[model samples]
Target: MLSANEIEQVYWLADSLGEPGQRIDDGLFLARVAMHARELPRNLRRFLADFRASNRSPACLVLGYPVDEVRMGPSPTACNRLREKTIDEIRLEIAAILISSCLGDVFGWRLQHEGSIIHDLAPRPEHEDVGLGTGSRQHINWHTEDSFHPYRADYVGLFCVRNSHRVATTIGALDPDQLSKRHRRLLSAPLFTFRPDPSYLMSKAHPLPGTDRGGILFGDPENLCLRFDQDYIDWPDDIDGIAEAVETLRRVIEASLIHMPLRSGDFLLLNNRRAVHGRPAFTPTYRGTDRWLKRINITRNLERSRRRRQSDFDRVIYV
Candidate 1:
């Protein structure tokens, strides 16, 4: 949470941008935000440092940030049309980017949400169960964000613009200590594959074809990373044990899942590789008063995805 003084500082910095809805390069925007980060209160800086380096937890919540009341209009019902941004939205996105820069560099994908650097999370009636953010009524089963892609985010950041209904976001982490030796061994094997979600295919004319294949868990046993999507993964027909193990894992996660409802001014950061997040079924009023949230993906290193990138200037991954 930022203090009133800190909030004023942020507002001043955002106002210095001169105009609302102006497009800024990622490098320039990050540099400007980083410069002002030094002015942040001591406790806020320490919290950002500790949270970015910590390995024990997969998610954390921040409270008490300030949101503009008059400028922020009703929530939109779609993710496309990225040119529109309100004064409040601009300030919120800048604030979010500052916090995320502590974790890593933020990025986008060409085949996801129209290559939006900052994506919207609003209920779209036409797509309620399409494996996308707009799927509000259908249970958005737990899965690592962009689990189908090799260049998935290292950290996922979300800022709640408005959530009057208190829509809860569910999250769960994998603990190696609880898994049996056999289950761990099976999960570490390269027997699992995840197909790209439907939303990615819809973003392109002729989408790339291929499934992401890898182990479900990786790294040290004490602190492992997970890559699983209940709706996207599939195992070999002959490998019945893997299937059973996955089902058991699913039940275990459900039993230990935590529900976090983000209110106005609430910001959350989740380790994308180590945690799975989802949302339960909810009714959307479709009236401009529906719940709204802004989201972005971050990576610790940009060079790791160079091969998948189209050009040096283009940050959005194509493959």
Candidate 2:
């Protein structure tokens, strides 16, 4: 949470960026947002720097940022959301992405929201039971963001526009160091496969379904990263004790899972590499005032996905 003065400083920065006259994908528009990030409150920048340095599973929340609920239009419908966004929507994206730029290069998937860098997540009556973020009537499962792809995000930033229903997001973390050497070795083996979730499958191009296989734990031993998605894993049933191993890890995550209810003006950042997040099912009012959140995905090494990107400046990854 920011102090009153700090909150004012943050809002002032957003206000200074007049109207976002250009589309989000426009080069000049994105440059303008990143340039303005130079003026963010010093404490906020310092805190983000420290969090990045930790290189461990962590979740941080910032409250007291201004969000004009009345000014924000109703939650977007379930159709293709590639059209124009309201002024309030653009304002929040500018502020949200500004904070995100401090972490790393933000990117999106071609199969999700039409390569949207900034995503609007809200309940859509047509997709109430979907496993994606727009889900409302069904509990979204705990999983790493874009778990099926090696180019998955390193961090995920979410800014709440509104949460009239008070839905709670569940998050849990697992450190490989907590397990025995044998268990750690088992998890580190490339014995698991993950398929693309419905979010990517819904793309208009209807990309061919593909599977990705990798170890659950990788990276430096002291600052381990994880990749997990219970719904899409396809481990060999004949593998001895694989189920037990998965159950063991699941239990740890279940025990550690915590419920966080976000409200207007709250911003949540999750370590997508280590933290698994989900949301419980909730009834929606659909009164144009349903829960709404703006989301962005950040990767420390954008170049690593060059094969999947069209050009140097293109942040949208192709399958």
Q: Highest lDDT: give the candidate number.
A: 2
lDDT of 1 by residue, 1-319 (tens): 7788766775676666526766643555666665666665567668877877885678877666787644777787876555577777777777777667777777788776676667888888888666568768887888898887888898898888888899999999877777788888888788888888877777554556479888888777767788888888888878657877787777777777999888988888898877789888888898877878888888888779887776554567766
lDDT of each: 0.77, 0.81
Per-residue lDDT of candidate 2, residues 133-162 (tens digit): 887888888889889898889999888889
Tell me how many clashing residue pairs each candidate has.
0, 0
Q: Alpha carbon lDDT of residue 92, candidate 2?
A: 76
How does each model score on TM-score? 0.92, 0.95
lDDT of 1: 0.77
lDDT for position 47 in model 2: 86
At residue 274, candidate 2 shows an lDDT of 80
